[model samples]
Target chain A: MAKGGKTLGEEALQQVARRFAVLGEPMRLRILQSLMDGELPVNSLVEATGGTQTNVSRHLQTLAAAGLVARRREGAQVFYSVADPSIFELCELVCGGIRKSLAAQAGSLR
Target chain B: MAKGGKTLGEEALQQVARRFAVLGEPMRLRILQSLMDGELPVNSLVEATGGTQTNVSRHLQTLAAAGLVARRREGAQVFYSVADPSIFELCELVCGGIRKSLAAQAGSLR
Candidate 1:
């Protein structure tokens, strides 16, 4: 995105930082990873992440507030799915960056 | 890139989370944005980011510790530059994601 070519204003910068902050938690990332395949109910997410129902639900709320995940209700059950497909790409970029950083560190150690 | 296809183990997940958490701070992001073009001395970053020398230096230390920025000592002055070019791409992806999210919200409102 050429958007990176220009400097971001304060508000926009904060928005960007907020998104990163939202994804910074270990449990939050775990929950997102659990939903990588598709949508799942709260119970499934709880099982998939090995988090308690309450903890999973709390993270879901945070993710929903960030607009990174979508929520749906069917009867008494709640289902959640990734609202933004770009999220996977974001994670991919971070992983790639980490790998490069590690490789650089190893090279420096040599 | 394809690394995102596999689930990250606990240690790796924490590392990823740590990277994200480091980027979460507004002041740190500001410092990074200031250095986006090229390397600069501490004084120049202070002027560009409008942060005090102490504040800018602190953020630089955080960025350096995260291995996101590189530091060099030229004579008595310290210079900093982006250690990872992937950082630009990461911010670009994030900006794109935020644009899409805002667009979706606008559509919902319409």
Candidate 2:
């Protein structure tokens, strides 16, 4: 259930899960990280992520399909950028959690 | 690569992806949501999520393994609670992204 006494609709819950699932791929995350500074063409993403053009293109399609990225064309080059900037904050929150979890584990070893 | 020109190790990237993958299941999300209020025993979680005892137990084990939830035993009952509260923030961020995506889709449709 969400705020108040109403339960989150099943569809909404599934959508949220799907969003997480889309972000679960390391290649996708790498592509997003590369685009953090600004929009970059597919070739640039391939170079930045050290991934093949085919692999980077595949992940870019996945991110665009998830609405996490937007694609544009400037002449012959196709560029991708973070459509949802909130993703950076999401990564930050997860990173913070990971840091805390690691700290707890380290403390437990002492 | 992260800020300061240091690239995140492959292991760290995989860990982050794993964390997101663990949250990708709707049933797991449901289990976490049920525990949002506080700790609950397996029986209570089974009821709250409307999942069978065996299923809820399995999800709880997965959650615990991920260090997303903590396990406690008292007398004859084992209880579970959120070990990482930052998950709620993560969910909120994903939910916000979904809402934005949906709104944009709706706007484009109109």
Candidate 3:
């Protein structure tokens, strides 16, 4: 998406950055990763991350707002699961992309 | 990659968070986005995003430290570019994943 005329100014970039900032928290990453498995309850999520209930709940709410994860009321418990696997693809691709770039840089150094 | 026993503790999450934090900046996103267009010089990058030299330089360091971007000196001026396209995949995937997740939630609400 080349902005031949520089269409994507700081404002547009900031919008995307907000989403990235929400994902900046490690607990959020772990939370998102957990959702990768399937929908899981809040208690189970807390146990999975070994994080405080308050912390886990906070991160879940952020991810939910970003559309990265979702929550569902399963009877007495509230299950927090990933919004979808497409996010996984993004994680894998981004990681893969950076790894590949690093390898290429290393190659030039040789 | 199941963390059957919470292999990814809070520490691991912090490491990932730092990386995310670097990407969290708007100027950095624009920088990374421009790098997506193969590779470009620092001046071109600055012009593309309409940001200051100092801001661009600072962001480049953060991105480089995170292994998300790289640089090469072309004679006197330095050319900075994204570490790789895979990072693009991550961006696309993350955005797409979240969009999909949100859509699903909206559906459930209906």
> What DockQ do the predictions score, one after another?
0.83, 0.74, 0.52
- Judged by TM-score relative to the true structure, which candidate is superior, 2 or 3? 2
* Model 2 agreement with the true structure over A18-67: per-residue lDDT tens digits: 99998888999898888888999999999998999998998889899999
User: How much is the lDDT of residue A40 in candidate 1?
Assistant: 94
- Which segments of candidate 1 are over 4 A away from where they belong? A1-5, B1-4
In Å, what is the interface RMSD of model 3? 3.0
User: Which sections of candidate 3 miss by over 4 Å?
Assistant: A1-12, A101-110, B1-17, B98-110
How far is B80's C-alpha from truth in model 1 (Å)? 0.4
Query: Can you give the TM-score per candidate against the true fold?
Result: 0.94, 0.91, 0.77
Q: Candidate 3 chain A: minimum summed lDDT over ten consecutive residues — where? A: A1-10
Kept native contacts, fraction for each prediction: 0.80, 0.72, 0.71
Q: Each prediction's Cα lDDT score?
A: 0.89, 0.88, 0.71
Error of 1 at A96 (Å): 1.0
Model 3, A65-94: lDDT tens digits are 777776789789998776565655545554
Evaluate model 3 with DockQ and give the value. 0.52
State residue B67's C-alpha deviation in candidate 2, in Å.
1.0
- CAPRI tier for the interface of model 2: medium
Off by over 4 Å in 2: A1-7, B1-7
Where does candidate 2 chain B have its weakest 10-residue lDDT segment? Answer: B1-10
